[model samples]
Target: MTLGLPDHLVEPILSRALARASHWFALTCLAGALLSALSLGLTYEAGLLWMAVLSVLAMAALLVTLSLRPTVVLTIAYLLVGTGGTYLYTTDLLGLPDVFPASNMFLAALPKLALIMVGGAGSGALTGVLWSTAGFVLAETVTVIAAAEAEVTYLPDGFTISACLFLVAVLLLAGTARRPHRAAQSAIHRAVHADQSRLLRQDLDLRALDLNQDTTLNELIALSRARAGPLTENLSGSIRAALHRLRGTDWLTDADAHRVSHSPGADAWLTSEVYLAIERCRDRGLVVDVIGDRSALGRLDPVVDRELGLAVQQCLINVILHAGIVSAEVDIGGDGGIFSVMVMDAGRGFTESETGADRLGLRQAVRRRIKRLGGSVTVLTRPDAGTSVLLSVPAAAPAAAPDGQGTR
Candidate 1:
């Protein structure tokens, strides 16, 4: 049986109980005396009647001291009054037989003894109960046996049987006191440990949250955007500059430069696939030299198939970001599981040192994308010269490759 009182929060209650020990004793004594008075009236015992009277008088004495001294003094008064009251009840008043004559029944006043030991909730009462009950039973049994032999007090066997049940009450009180306190303490320990476990779980969740932020998915994406943006811009500008130079040199006629080299159907396909590429490059000032099969790329369903569209998109992004350009050129060719998208340029090229962020936009964003679609991308470049991206992918083709040319 748990006490059901809060253990950690009970200190103040305990201290107050201790502080008012004398009052508690005095009040309990008064209550016991009234009970004894009733017992005396019922049993017609003059001794018990005086015990009741003396107990009531002791209460008056304790009350008198309350006005004359501090509360602690009142407590001391209660203990004094209680002890005196017990003796008076036993000897001068109640004439109650000493159940434990070799021991002291005064020692068995539970609340009084408990207060003296640990301020009214400790081992004193239990000890007193155990000692007194044991001694009473053994001594009374022996005394009654001897009395029967001597023809002393008239206690029939039936009366003796009923009287001995008092031992049961004493045992009950002792057992009750001991069990609940230990149970309460055990409950408190379990509660504290449960709270600690909950705190540990909360700490782990916080650590996981911390781990997920700042250095995870969002951080990587931000870094990718930063690095990829400028590379795309610079490549476009270089291509446009090369275009003006090529036109001024008269190296290619308008027919040579502007002619669509593929079948009109292929030309439409190429336009569809490469339109975003052209727009992206032009926005950043790159010049595109549309060469070879210009109409071939759009033959596949860029509008219907998302993966194909995204692959085409990344190819253009890569041309702008990774291919250092003099003139951006696309050589679209091949058929059925074999297609090539060559983006030719003039500048410094890829190297082993360009890894991670420096290359994720090109490698992760573009090359890997086309490769996933069962296509391949090759980087052909050298320093101060040129670069070309060869993308060979599987697609059903209509005709052969073309050598188309356009300057933009």
Candidate 2:
């Protein structure tokens, strides 16, 4: 059995799938109209030929927009154009008694197909159904008006009505099925968390074993020296330190305990050079909120860590100097052996082309340093929009020595 999609991904995936299906359906309808017209030798008529050419061009524009930059506004605009084109095409065909009943029905159904596509363009099932309903009302109104002008009997095509109803029903069913979909998503999340917890425990166990081995060796040395005579001050201090380690009393101080308890990955936060940069920014009256998987920073080697820290410092400096905002956010995450850092600020953003060549803060400091370490920097900004700078680097590994040996 296949488990359903995650809760967060369901709507987007559904919308895209529906949009693709609707595009194909509309294309099929358009193709049918063209083929029917051609087979009847009506392609030679000036009025019908002009309508066909314009309709094809309009359809091509709609297809291109849907493929490149699909928006709800553009979808509605295309639907209106399609409805008008369908009415004109149908009116021209109505004057010809030679038109087959199948061709007539197909021509009448074009506007309804366009309206049905509106449903697929929505961000969610409910939204799509509402948009589709509005399009249907508009299309039917236009159809009735066209038939009256032609002085022909107007009968709603059964196929178009059924298609409209089927689309609405599918959307409603999808809306109602959200509860079970969420449950499946929750089950998957729980399973993933359990697996990560198991891996974390194994790693912690290995670290503890190493600490214990070192502590045991120091304790034995102290005890052997003490058997000969009273312990020296250094030996006594060593024994005391080992006892503290064994009891886990000195693992974290009170301040450190609080920090770790409040911050999920305080170990890396407190140890990484990024922490130093944050403190510096804090001193300069910049409020930086650090979040995400901060512990992922621990995977970076010293050289990579230092470079990343400096790059982040430069990003924060730019936010303070140019963004006109006193606050920023730094997020850390990693996936598939790549560590990522994002610095974001909601302030005045500048266009890349507007900046002078002398503005080297970002080009030299942020981008070049990360690039030297085989990393990438991406900057996203526009006038009035916020700025987000992403820095990504490979995870830690031993550096190559001059003699062709790998050294940690």
Candidate 3:
């Protein structure tokens, strides 16, 4: 579900956008192509073949995304190739050094940024940082060249100034154009995926609406505030993440939370509020099999209890709606002072968004919860490959005390 070329072109442009209209690759590609066609006299047979080849390849890549499955991998591969092709094409006309490197910059920058936003930091920081710097440097060089050209004596100063200014203006325009024109945020008529997201949101709203409303916001907040003390049990990260999201969107201020509520017993506090969360999911017909203990032994850690609950619920909702999944499995357990929750579904797993920005439903919901709790999530999903989500949180107390610290 997509709009038209007018809108579709914005996908990559929006990817590398900066604060004050910064990304220049898209503009460079545009101006380069136009100038090349005009200056080359459009007469070289070999050049004509290159043009045809480029057009065919680009179209074929995009076509596969529309007419096939596995859009994530295809999109990533196509974008890399297309970026490289744009650099090569621009180089053929403008002769830039290391065009592939420049294209690789575009290929890396946006997706990497987006990946971080949605919990892909599982890849580690150093690699992500190096790649980001390389992309930005290459992108900047390609863009700045237009404004840095030498003055031409044959051309009038005004004309040269005007031409340079025009070039700057175009780069600026292209630079500004690279904002988040996310597929998740597009005109309904043109959006290839709006309905899918809309459905997922609807499910969440419906569920939230059905919850108990008589509970006080302060009570919920107190429930979320992590206890500071020498404790024997603790909540995990996923539960804490869910709590933060629950407060941010649902609670607003404590006043907003007054109506909705959750009260964790001792068992839930020790095992992870995730245990009870799975029960809620099962009540909604979302669980294929629930395997976990719901009883515990201590005060519930505020952060983990709330977030892990919400994350679990969101995961279930995502599968029910998008995974093409009929059944799922849930496991909540602890190992080495770490409370973990694993959800597996026979549905197709997470697909990297075609444009990079997380979609409105699954990614945003999960990430908001995960990040707020100082936790993380991972998705190993492919078209028809099934989906698996593993969430872990620090436990309240270790089964075996460290050396010389057996007594707390």
Q: How much RMSD separates candidate 3 from the native structure?
A: 20.8
**Once superposed on the true structure, which residue ranges of model 3 sit more than 4 Å away at CA?**
1-276, 292-300, 353-358, 397-408
242-330 in candidate 3: lDDT tens per residue?
A: 55655555533364454245545433543655655664444343535766643331332555566667788788777766665447887
For residues 1-408, write the lDDT of model 2, one tens digit per residue. Answer: 233444444556777777677667767776766665454435545455457446645764675576456687787777777777676666665545544333326566764576565677776788878877876777677667766766667777777777788888887776546655455554654465567779977876776787778897768966865657766888889888888887663444575445545454567677898877876665455779988987788788887788788889999988877786778999999998899999999988999888989889899888777777777899999987989999988886443232323222
Off by over 4 Å in 1: 1-267, 303-326, 397-408
Give Cα-based local distance difference scores for all models. 0.47, 0.71, 0.45
* lDDT score for candidate 3 against the true structure: 0.45
Q: Assess candidate 2 and give its TM-score to the true structure.
A: 0.49
Q: Model 2, residue 51: displacement in angstroms?
A: 1.4
RMSD of 1: 33.6
Question: Tens digit of lDDT per residue, candidate 1, span 1-408?
Answer: 222443322433443343355345435545665565556656665544555475656555654455244354454555455445444443332133433332123322322232232123222334333333442343334434434433335232332233224433433343443434545454654565467778977875665465445234454454455654455654455445544543342333466434424357555654564655554444344556666655555555453223444454565555555554424666667566565666676644556255467556556655656655555677766665666667666664232212211110
TM-score of 1: 0.30
Candidate 3: worst 10 consecutive residues by lDDT?
A: 114-123
Model 1 per-residue lDDT at 196: 75
Q: Sorted on TM-score, highest at the top, how do the candidates line up?
A: 2, 3, 1
Each prediction's TM-score versus the true structure: 0.30, 0.49, 0.30
Best by TM-score: 2
